[model samples]
Target: MDWQEISGNWVLIPPRPSAIVHFLGGAFVATAPQLTYRWLLEELAGQGYAVVATPFVNTLDHVAIARDVLNKFENALDRLYATKTLRKAYFPIYGIGHSMGCKLHLLIGSLFDVERAGNILISFNNYAARDAIPIVEQISPVFNVEFTPSPQETNRLVQEHYQIRRNLLVKFADDNIDQSILLAKLLQPRFPGMVAIQTMAGNHQTPLGQDVSWPVGQVFTPLDAIGQWVKQQVYRELNQLKREILRWLNPLS
Candidate 1:
């Protein structure tokens, strides 16, 4: 699947879409959204989902970043409508987020009136700067800088403000940083619609790339089953992830 950007938006437009998905990546780098979420985005695109992936610089000020996501979504929609690529842009809009991306989507759902159809949160976490990066703990005193929406602040905001209807929280088996439990705990009280938590067979980085080192631009031996086995193993986690997302998004279908 090939997609070009319009007005600083990377849009993966499918021929016909079951839904429109806005993809948000994790923290640390302000790199290209397609670069980090390529595997997941491609899979979702193949499954008839139009995905708009946006990049952002990770910062302590998460509230501002959340607002930026909303702005990016609007800009992408503007471009799609102007180009006439979206014949009918009335499909339900969904937000899919990983790590810090999950926090941003949750913030948007809570604070903004975006009318999101659903939200898929994977491995959500809101760590203080000191805990998020152990090294930062050592130097925090020198800069007197603190991470905005620290763990405590994140919990408080979501507990009081989150208002999304349909949500699917995913947790991996071996991920210590799987903070879905905490997020589910906070949402159970306020969320009126379906709030489901699912555990899959992978780690925090499972949905990001589907594999740790291989299957990414690897030169394989020119054999059929050998290559196919490796390919399946490489993307097992993400394959399952995509399937789960489709099931949740269109349960009746």
Candidate 2:
């Protein structure tokens, strides 16, 4: 697999024992100019946490592109794990994704179901809402609401799609408020303490864009204010995780 270094400043935060932190990029974008998390990485390394960022090309077409990028990331993780880097026995791995990257994270996280595989999604939205237009068009011709598929059959099909939508929303909330709520619900069942969602006030692209001021200082524009908020949140979460790891390793005080 061809791997590309996401152009931008990247810093590695060393973790005690040895843990891996994976940073996933957004859709149609390679890396953010601000290089969000540089400060966090330094802080984490100081506290004994190893951090790494894998830059992948963001091509928004088929799922193969995302899968390929994620595969490359997984390979990097394998290398790190083989090197005997972190403190945790199972290699505590956390994933941070923005926008479409968040969707990719869910797909990968769900597929792997690793022991310590935790995830943080920023600016996550209901996948259905984001792709509603296309989904509707695709299924519209299959089932005619006016005639074919009978009432029972129509109900089943509609219910199936509805469930899919529900799952998407539950996995990724459209805005910060609802997004946090959705994340809480989803994690409570499978990973009560492992999942976290911090909804910063911004649209989808905020986490990737560094600057918050643009398009007349409005939240909607080329980028959103949430971009800064997401970066700050990532740093905070990484540092917090590092502290917890330190505390775990050295409990007596």
Model 1 lDDT per residue over 93-174, tens place: 9999998899999888878888888899988887778778778888998986667766787788889988787899999998
Minimal lDDT window, size 10, model 2: 161-170
Q: How many residue pairs clash in each candidate?
A: 0, 14
Compare the candidates by lDDT and give the number of the best one. Answer: 1
- Stretches of model 2 off by over 4 angstroms after superposition: 1-18, 32-46, 60-62, 81-90, 128-180, 190-253
Tens-place lDDT per residue, model 2, 116-202, is 344555554333322423545566567522222222332333233221111212122234423435444554455334443443334
- Estimated TM-score for each candidate: 0.90, 0.49
> In candidate 1, which residue pairs clash?
none
The CA lDDT at 137 in model 1 is: 81
lDDT score, candidate 1, position 9: 64
Instruction: Tell me how many residue pairs clash in candidate 2.
Output: 14
Instruction: Report every candidate's CA lDDT.
Output: 0.82, 0.44
What CA root-mean-square deviation does each model show from the true structure? Answer: 3.4, 10.9
